[model samples]
Target: MTGFHFTVLIQLLYRVGKAPTVILQPNRTVVYRGERVTLRCEIWGGGGTEWTYEWKTNNGNAEKSSNEYIINRVSDTNSGKYSCMARGDHQLTEWSDAVTLTVRLSKPTVILEPSGPVVYRGEKVTLRCEIWGGGGTEWTYEWKTNNGNAEKSSNEYRINRVSDTNSGEYSCMARGDHQLTEWSDAVTLTVRLSKPTVILEPSGPVVYSGEKVTLRCEIWEGGRRTQWTYEWKRNNGNAEKRSREYRIITVNEYHSGKYSCMARGDHQLTEWSDAVTLTVRLPITPTVIKQPSWAQIYRGERVTLRCEIQDDGGTQWTYEWRPNNINSPTSSEFMITADSRGYYSCRGRRDSFTITKWGVITLTVFNSHPAASLSVSPDRVQHLIDQSVTMNCGGNDTKWRMRRFTGSTSPSYVQCSNWGTMHGSSCTINRLEDHSGVYWCESGSGEFSNAVNITVQDDYYDVIILVSPVHPVTEGDPVTLSCRDKEQNLLSNVIFYHNNKLINNDSRGELKISAVSKSDEGFYKCQHSGKESPRSWMSVRGEKD
Candidate 1:
């Protein structure tokens, strides 16, 4: 009995004693193809003993000196029930329970966060490699790109501060336990560095006050419109508006500044646009300039007036005149009638309905016809008979003729040619008895000029004559009258008379009135050396503002 028990104990020592347990990494039954798997054989109650492992698969069986059976790269043939056994020096363990392993041909899908194809510079981009049907499996990723890059071993690939050089087609493959999956579809990445452009309406570096202004932020990319949020800035300050267009209803001087804009969309922010300058200016003041350059206007006369504005170069302006009753034209030059006498004002209007200050002017008009002026060469009203005298008709007409009314002539009206030598608008005649009458000028339309009385003296006696102006003098003008003898010599101790009344008895032989007004208009005469001169009229015109 002792020998038989020894034999049984010796056989049990070399035969199976405890069953081995198959331990699988990841503890999963389903796995992807090309995945790495390891089966470890564990023996209970077998301590401190070296053992060889025997692995059984659906395809075949293999023996390894190590207690663990490892598949470097699992394939479809590796998908089957796996069992492991351990062999010791003096004892052996039975085969552990079968562990099923499924090596599937499932491909992984690469997902891109913030999935837009284009990304701006200085942006953070993340690419993820996902394995399908790979639960409970730790995966490592291998990334590929058109642009050369260092290999990475992570499920997620992150690009920080990405730039234009980092743009290319990117693909990734997942590796779990030393097995690699198929590369996913390429997730194209386009890094853009293009900036936006700012545009201003009316394109003015200088704009008038109270004018409308508009600013636009534009982005050009393949001529397609993109939905983006805009940011506008003035003078490089904070954002003013978020819309693509910024408008100002009535721009003033306070609105003048440099402007810029930028855009952000699809998790990307573009660079700020080049700054555009804007300037606002005050409205110009217009000035009214008269063409005739006269303070007084006469009837039957046409005057041209111009509206002038400073700093209006390269600008189109329309004129507006106040006192619109005159029916003024819209041009800068206005033709004014004599009847349109009053205060005139003008303003300039721009194309955008901006206006300038009003410019004012005053016009004075005379209704009645003014007598033509007559000038004599001798500057005196008295002359001796048979003495040569010249007279000229001064006026705005060319049809003026020198005429005289002599009481002794056959007809009362006669031209200077009938009794003297006639020139163009002038006549030279030898003084005779018939010439000692009222001399004047007459136009072809029967309008008469001021008449002057001439006394024909028989000899060079103690005779006196008055020298006065023949034409009407404007108000605020100077007038002078002097007395002369028959020989054309000035005399002293003169007594001046106005309207047959003694006004002055001065010894200067002349009367000087500074700033003559309408009150100074009357018939004036002077007496010198006990000789009284003929009365002459001094006409004065008034100025109105």
Candidate 2:
């Protein structure tokens, strides 16, 4: 390897380096008027070489012994593309890439937070001074209004409580490091007084309990209608509400007090309204009492209903009735007659504005006599000939006799000895064909009880009878009837008739009447395969209370 003893020398050289890059002090290409800007030429891998920079701009080129070029106060004439080159070690580096600079000379703008400068007195108002292209600059704001000029160190001018004196044409300007910007366009502010008035709906000092009332807060002058929030106070206590009006669906004695209202907007509360006094009077409720107190009355019977108001100290009052009969007396008592089988209500009025709650009652009346009831020992639709049966008469009255009708010109009333054995209220009889008739109990005063039909049938005729209700049925009640043979077995494939006319042919052999009314009362009968039953009478009572 030492043969020849000769060495070779190689020279390595690193060119000056890649092109340098131009950088801004704040790293932003945009600058504002009177703003300080510094441009730097950065070289990488220079090996700690000291370099001098040449800055090129649209205006001209300048050479500096340092790498940084600074503009103390930039103006519109300083806006352009700028680049720099570095010279070190007797070699020149490539020109750095260009950076664009924008300088704005226009005046700043005045911006309000709520946009609209119209506000109410005692409200918070904020005014902001905005510089469109003046980023990265610390500015001092000057607020100029009709009042005077104010030098606020911050960009925002705030008034914690703006008064009427603060309303006027407002303009703003900004001062940065170098010079002061021109005044912006004027923005008008209007401050108004917001004093509310409490208005009662009825406009009356006294209102009856259980009446509807409303209290409205009417603002004298304020901002936009949508900007206001309402608060109601009763006797210095807070009432929760948001709308302008506070309503009470049912005002009672507890609601009676001094009420006032205030409005809030723009972080300010208006003055409380004048208090309005309200007095809620308890209304008198009258009760209706019926004289000769009874649940029911005869058609021609007389009765009296009196409207009595409790705690009334001999106050002269008039009465009002639901029927409002033209010929009715204005007194508290109302005389009921034959046509008085319905609901009755009454109310008392001491004056046009004072009235009591209505009191209501019901009266039931019947057309026929409802004295007693007659029943049989073994209840059945029809009884076999020569079968023993007992009949009983019972009611509030005891003096009664069994009466029967058998197509006779004159009806006969008798005791058990003539037809059956009598004991207390019951009579036992051995049924005969002649005993088949409509039987009932008759009082000594000629009042009769509900009647029943005692049918006696012989087995020889293969007879059938209509099974119907024995007692009178009230209106709006369901009634059903069926057909049966002599053996007491229900029959099918039967056709029913009302008042001797065909009503319907039921598959279930039943005549069903739903919500039976007075029009349904009449004689009802049924017919099976070939035999027809005897027609039975059905009664329907009128509606009652």
Candidate 3:
């Protein structure tokens, strides 16, 4: 059986092979230019033989068969039955189903997504087209406008400029591939008008330091004026407001924000063009800065510091104390019941909002003193040695410390060793000559008690003009001076005036001068008017220095 099988295989392999060839197909079809079409044939299995193919058509006269059948751009003459044949052993003929072609005709489709037929001219827009889905080769597109000649393309057609002339019933034709796809439905595109521009009045470059200014924007291409409002905001900050043409009555640092505008034709507002900003530069900088940045108060003792903004900031200004005890704290004048000593800070907001509040008064509440200790009053004073002194001790009070201030500076004087057992809210120094400074107290919690001042006979003066230029001016050079008391201080900056003219101002115990001469000499004084204290002065001097 194996031998017989091998013999059979050998005989099968010895069979002769014939050349593979191609033949025209039956059921032929025709195509038009710019139309998506397919060319099909009646395929006969030529068994394992690759064949070359050619199609020929008989002229419309039906007498002569020309070998020029087309797959695309098919003319009417290329529409007859195309016959295909193979020629090995003899000529075998295969006739295609008849096809009708139209080369001069084309159908194009229009695909578009209008960004509002009412388009703003000079802005960009697009028109799109695709072969309705499955794309093919030999396809060309034809397009015609109401005013221009027809256009042709393989894929897409575009109208860059659109107007009433360009605005007509738009249509397109797709032609060429082997099979023709039906033409697409037509679409109409209409052109619309654009929005008008706006302008600012009063012309910029006008100086407006304080007051509400009005800015108006006019629209020329007036239609139905919908929401004809304006927009105003700062480059920074949470303050933003809107209205038709902005109206700002009071202007300051906050008012020096940014400004921009857009005209809203009802619900739809045009995009803002370029931005315009108003800058309100401050006339002064704060002089004093505090540590812990806030303060806690007891009842009435008195606390204050002197800080000055800029000298040219003018005298028509007032001062305030900022507690910072509240979140988003604001600057204010005196508000605490008494002198306080705690974490605090301050800044100057325009007083136009309202009067400012402050925090620096002292109030010594006579709470229940510890049974194991006693309490005292009159925290500070001057005295000689052997003077009868009173001291109070309280068992309830555990932590303890004493304070002293001189030359407007505060430093620790006494502290508890075993505070848990120590007592006394008040203690007097026994006739001390070595002490002449401001005083305050502290406990274990690290919170300083209300401040007080104790003085002993002393003849020492330390003065530095922190706010003034070091050198004296000859003629008209700006010069300033600072006077120190080495006594009371200020939470606010201090201002200096010599010869009734403003020289320098600062929160530091100092003063300054911008333009000065020998004639500008006179007496100088500093006063912490923010919350406490009367005016304080420096020793009289001449410009000779």
Candidate 4:
């Protein structure tokens, strides 16, 4: 081969083994503020071989000679076009394609004071717009809420006495001269309402024993009814109930106290309501006192009936007295000249409406007969076992003896000895027995006093008749009759008798009268399987005349 042929072969071999092309590392052109950005020089076709690199900007400025061009902190000053070249052992490659580096302006942000995004009613809050880079006082702030433009212009927005209508998403932007920045990150603001009020049912705070009471708590907020949880506190203690309404089956004196409530929903708790008070009172029972505690008083003598209260405090009392077939008198103590015979009852009053139970007494005024007359205390014809009975022979005479008669035997009078004790003109019988009979007084001169019939019964074995609302029931009122056995257990399938005549045969052994009249007043008894209960008298008083 000649020299020309050899040179052509060498040129063809050098063209096949040429240097690789240089290129930029990253394809992106945008960079943010305060970010670390790196531009690298890369060779595309040089099969795993290393090369030296050099970088330059479009402004003709020389950068570093390393394989990578780095900007520790990029800003607006770093914006330009960049290119790189790679150097191999044989020759240097051409410049890479130019890459535009864009450094954008920083975005502004919105911040809320007092930490939380929620504020209660009647409270103040502040929202501040912040931009990192310094742009002097010429920067104007604009705000938007819930995607709608707001009419404020200050950097700091102050809200006074915020309400529920002020809740929305808020954002801000900065404008200086002819340049306006993009909107900042959005923040949410929530305005809440205060707590609700609690109310009592029946519209009154006073409660009596054996009565039911109810308390209700109401909340008006934006949520489903089932989402709310109610908490109730009695006298400032821990929660006792977790329902909207609190109920009391029965109220007593110990149940008197204050009450409050609150509501919790949506991971938030509302303030407590204003406290309310409850007052519970006990049943009132008054005492009746009869002056000159004697079995009988002569005509033209002075007698007094007094009404009193027991174990009571912090109360002022008035009184009322009712005598049979006569107008009632209002006084604590009533005085009368013993010229009439009647049944009398008295009651005490705390206020014009609040009254105690009535207590009954019987008074008998006797005329002066030439012979002595015998009378009994309590004036009741029937007496219970284990009860005391007293008999008095009217007169100051000392030589008086007591006698008891059984059946209709002639002259069959037995002198009192083992049956009772005698104390000058009076005889006392304790622990009455079934054999006790009619009694009369006998003077030393063989003259006899008036006779009185006395009947004795066993209190434990006798049936009890229960009257709803107790005895002395007012006329034109509903009444219920219940028969109980000696053990206080209710008797079923019993027959009720009024005035010794069968009136009703009920399975539940109860008799009810829808409205009572004067004719309903009578003696009542109950009978079960050939056993009869002692008669109990029911008294119904008419309305005031």
Cα lDDT, all candidates: 0.74, 0.74, 0.41, 0.68
TM-score per prediction, in order, is 0.35, 0.31, 0.28, 0.34
TM-score (C-alpha) between model 4 and the true structure: 0.34
lDDT of 2 by residue, 263-332 (tens): 8877767788889998897876789887445454555343568899874366677998877764355789
Best candidate, TM-score: 1
* Model 3, position 317: C-alpha lDDT score: 43
lDDT of 4 by residue, 289-337 (tens): 7654446654534456777777336566677777633324476777554
| lDDT (Cα, tens digit) per residue for candidate 3, span 23-109 | 233332334444443443334454444333445445333322223333443344444443443322223434444444434343445
Q: Using TM-score as the measure, name the better of candidate 1 and candidate 4.
A: 1
lDDT of 4 at 326: 39
Of the two candidates 1 and 2, the one with more favorable TM-score, higher being better, is 1
Local error of candidate 3 at residue 232 (angstroms): 17
Cα RMSDs, all models: 33.2, 24.9, 18.6, 26.8
Name the regions of candidate 1 deviating beyond 4 angstroms: 1-194, 221-223, 322-328, 370-545
lDDT at 510, model 1: 77
